[model samples]
Target: MLTGTVKWFNNPKGYGFIQAQEGTENQDVLIHYSVIEMDGFKTLKAGQTVSFDVGQGPKGLIATKVLPDNGQGAKVDNTEVLEKDSSLA
Candidate 1:
């Protein structure tokens, strides 16, 4: 697995981009929310550190089997939830 930081994620769209750390040729890898292996909140946040495997998709490079570097389950912030709700309202 390679280490990287999430560049950005669109929760509603269910996709994101991960900027891989040094040593990987594919810097920006596409990551889908479905591939993220988190317990509760299967979502990614920008600036969050993560480890993942590179895979070839129909379009281009993509991040697969992603996990948080901290090894703990991802926690969904209440503020984020509220923001999402407010946006919808």
Candidate 2:
């Protein structure tokens, strides 16, 4: 898996780009919300660090199975908040 920081994301459109942290040769990878493996609405925030698998798309490189880094916790969805609240009791 390649590690990178989210360059930008369009929450409504469900697409974003990740800037690879490896080297200058590595270009930004396209990330679609569908490819994200989250339980609920998957959305990425700018500057968030993430790890993902690299794949070749028709246009260019793309990211798959994207996950937030250890230091950066995963974004919370409504379901998760409810689950947490229920667990408290």
Candidate 3:
């Protein structure tokens, strides 16, 4: 997952961009409003930490399944967890 802060989201426009987290690449990711949790759209600000999946789009990588990754948030990097979540996590 890639992390970034919300650059700006024009709800009516149905899209937004995220400035990649510090120490990350110098590029921003595209985010479609629908990919995020509905309730978070309002509370999310210009600099909130979020994790997202990278999808290859016609334009480029698009952010999907965006969510607040708490400081202690563990990445989905463990095979055990992925297997469990896929089956019973």
Question: Best TM-score goes to which candidate?
Answer: 1
Q: Return the clash pairs for model 2, or none.
A: none
**Comparing 1 and 3 on TM-score, the stronger one:** 1
lDDT of 2 by residue, 2-72 (tens): 78999999887989899999842678899998888666667888898988998888988888679876533
Residue 3 CA displacement from its true place in model 1, Å: 0.5
Off by over 4 Å in 1: 72-74, 79-89
Model 1 C-alpha lDDT per residue in residues 1-89, reported as the tens digit of each score: 88899998988898999899864685589998888986776887889999998888888779878997776535666897798899788
lDDT digits (tens) for residues 39-83 of candidate 3: 533334456678777666787668767775563321233587577
Candidate 2, poorest ten consecutive residues by summed lDDT: 68-77
Assess the local accuracy of residue 79 in candidate 2 as a C-alpha lDDT between 0 and 100.
Answer: 87
Residue 50 CA displacement from its true place in model 1, Å: 0.4
Whose lDDT is higher: candidate 1's or candidate 3's?
1
> Which scores higher on lDDT, 2 or 3?
2
Error of 1 at 40 (Å): 1.1
